[model samples]
Target: MNASLLRRHRGFSLVELMVSVVIGLLALLFATRLIVSGEKNKDAAVGGSDSMQNGMLALFSLSSDATAAGWGLNDPMVAGCDTSFSDASGYALPAMPRAGASITPLAPVVIQSNGANPDLISFNSGTSQAGAGSIKLFADYTVGNTLTVDSKNPYGFNNGDVMVIAPLTPGSGKCTLFQLSGFGPPPNSTILVNSGGAYRFNAIAGLPNPYKQNLAYIYNLGSPTLMHFHTWTVSNGVLLLRATELAGAEAAGVSVTDNVVSIKAQYGFDARPPGPNPYDPTPGADGMQITAWSGTMIDADSDGVAGSPGDYQRIAAVRIAVVARSKNAEKPNSAGLCTATPVAPTVFASSAPAGVAAVPVQVNVAVAGDTVSWQCYRYRVFETIVQIRNAQWRP
Candidate 1:
């Protein structure tokens, strides 16, 4: 009884042990698969979210600067006179046109640095409009370094602050742009007495009677700012914001946001016939329909002239599109020379020129040494229409 009972009660046969081992291995394999799948999904979701943030930030920055295409220099009291701009503020300001027969004011907003590729846009504005603080002039002076503000106490102004005094009254005076030496009997006082030399605002010809008549404003352009010229573009898969004082020249680009593949822009010219004056966007029409929507300059007068007064001045607004992509390269996606499908934002009724069907822009990207398809990466498109404020104010 003892031998038989002991033999029957032995733990189990080798076959039973083998079967149990196989079941355990299968369960472990299933669990491993579930964990791996979950991790992959999480990575994709996180990557998409990050890409969206980057795309959004880039769009916001570009749109903000575009809205301010033409600000402070809308119409200077003195026409075709020289004005200073600030460069230390990390922006690229526009330069006046070279001496010519007719006074050709610099285009408030200009797109340069590329023909059809990534385009760069630049413009000028007041310090406060450009995100810098501003102060009001308390009283007017014939000529002096001392600038008195209406406030008993000067708020948010510093010693090295660059300031601009624009004429509130039509015949008051010219807009004076100058840098502050931060000099005053009492530092940072209500009256900011710049230690620098006198401003050349009144030196120009055709001076109206009184200098500072009404509420002449004092704006902090920036300490080292001559003029604020803000530029936006895309290079090396990143969107950049560059600033410079000279025209058509920009320093090294600063990466404002990442994963930006390309930037496309179109100009809207006001070329409608003289009538009730309807300002509308026609997606796929030529001539008076869309007027001219291209990277190149428009022939606003249709006089076969380039860079003419009628051309640049007729630009009413700008439409821009920014494309961003995911950072992570998914395993399913193989990389080489990938062609990103066209991406158009809602603002654009069509991508191409007038009469042409709107299509997603085809982006040719080089992703070498990676086995991934361009389609494997997720992309986000941001687009908007920016109305040139200064241009609108024009009669």
Candidate 2:
């Protein structure tokens, strides 16, 4: 009776056991697939958020600096002159080829375009306590001599103040940078620019040219350390800033943000003045109304020359677009291609003003030496139109 009972209660047969094992394996596989899908979705959401944050930051930084451009250098005599600068400490402005000369314009903002790549924009301003005021030279300023000014008004010049000696007329000559060492003798009418002795801006030789009296004026640029001369660019999927004040003559670039692939910009030009007087030749005649948008400065007044000082003066605002990419690349399909981003992003999507030709901006996503194809990554574009308040305030 015991033997018969034991046989009846025998464990599951081999076929039944195999079927149970198969069911367990199938359940385990389904759970793993579900977890993997959830993780992928989480990654996508996080990456999108990160790209948005980074893009906003880059736009803000660029806008803030660009808005402050030409603060101390806004005077007509200094704003658009091709400036000649030298820093014994190794600081120098990158020159752009204009007309038949290589010049660094003293305009509020200067944009350098890189076809199919990111553009480089530079912002220059001053932190003068005395404001953007100029003092005419009382006498001819020879090399190694002092700059004589009106004794009645000192213009609030202090020792170590960086000064720019610009031509009385724009485009006549190149502006030069110097430092005010101190007042000369008594009456304190003369400003000294002696080289050496803690003055890094002053060249040992002297001014590049002897500025004639009344033909040139001296504009105070305040302390060298407080000036704002910055250049912004995108490189290797990152935004960078090269500041002359912070880096001295080194002109070394500091990383600003990550995953920034490109920066596209255009000058908002007040080409035509208000109706009833469309041919006004006076600067800022349009009352800051943007009549045209262009990647390069145009001859707004029909002056027969592009990129002239007057053209630069008509730059009332700047429009910029910054592109940011996701932190992690999406997985490729079995065919070894990713469909994360089907097409390249577009900038300045809106229709341009009437009669204005639109310049299409082509964004290059295939970064050289990148392991993953550009199609594997997703991108976002942040754009803003920032008015140059300083330029608007000009006459």
TM-score of each: 0.58, 0.90
The numbered model that scores best in lDDT is 2
Candidate 2 to native Cα RMSD, angstroms: 3.0
Query: Mind giving the per-residue lDDT tens digits that candidate 1 earns over 211-299?
Result: 46346666565433344566677777778776544333346767787777667666666665433333322112332334556555655
In candidate 2, list every pair of residues with a backbone clash: 90-249, 91-249
User: Can you tell me which runs of candidate 2 are displaced by over 4 Å?
Assistant: 1-8, 247-250, 273-286, 352-358
C-alpha RMSD of each candidate structure in angstroms: 10.1, 3.0
Poorest lDDT segment (10 consecutive residues) of candidate 2: 277-286
Encode model 2's per-residue lDDT on 19-115: one tens digit a residue: 9999999999999989988887887888898899999999999999888887877676777788878776576675766676678887788888776
| Regions of model 1 farther than 4 Å from truth | 1-8, 75-105, 113-117, 126-226, 244-250, 274-292, 333-360, 365-375
